[model samples]
Target: MNYDDRRASPRYPLRAFAELGSSDREWAAHVLDISYYGARIALLDEYNLCAGDPIRLRLEIPEMQVPEGMLPYLHLEGTLVHQQEHMLGIQYEPASELDAELLKQILANLNK
Candidate 1:
């Protein structure tokens, strides 16, 4: 089967625990793939995460492997842009300068 790749930035496959929610709700999820712009996460539990809804993402990162001085988690605010069954697609908002650099470093390490 043939598939078209429409992503502006390449995505790296990563299996990591993550948290997705709003101020009032949160759910356990596993990150399947990630890029600087967004990520695709599989829910560990049932929830109603819909497109256009604001959400916060907290993804666990290995402290030892990350660039020095970076935190052990990726925390960002985003919007749910798509969903399929148990997976939710998140589009991250403009993040802090540090967060952006950390994401770049993380992606580089993942691809190594």
Candidate 2:
């Protein structure tokens, strides 16, 4: 079966820089795409992350403008669900209402 067919939600193509953090370390990652429940990312460096490992992600959206000293980012917590070479798939945990709303807005903008 195709990967999209197995997903719980539709994925939107998104290209952005991000930071992926695990309990012991962090890596610079590139956001390939995202869905309400998960995201696909490519790490800039090598690391040994496996399926079911917990992780934190902070996506930096360049299109969104913020005040001085502030950064426009979306922070999410998830588990590693898939990995191949430098790329990995993440299944996000349930987010707060604010985060959910923000994600929805981002997805909507992507469609335009």
Q: What does candidate 2's lDDT look like per residue over 48-83, in tens digits?
A: 789999999988876663333543777889999989
TM-scores for every candidate against the unseen true structure: 0.87, 0.87
Residue pairs with backbone overlap in model 2: none
Q: What lDDT would candidate 2 get against the real structure?
A: 0.84
Q: What do the candidate models score in CA lDDT, each in turn? A: 0.81, 0.84
Candidate 1 residue-wise lDDT at 16: 85
* Superposed model 1: Cα runs more than 4 Å off: 1-4
Clashes of each: 0, 0
lDDT by residue for model 1 over 1-112, one digit each (tens)? Answer: 3211655688889988888888689998899999888889998687866789999898888666577777888787889988889978888943578777778888999889
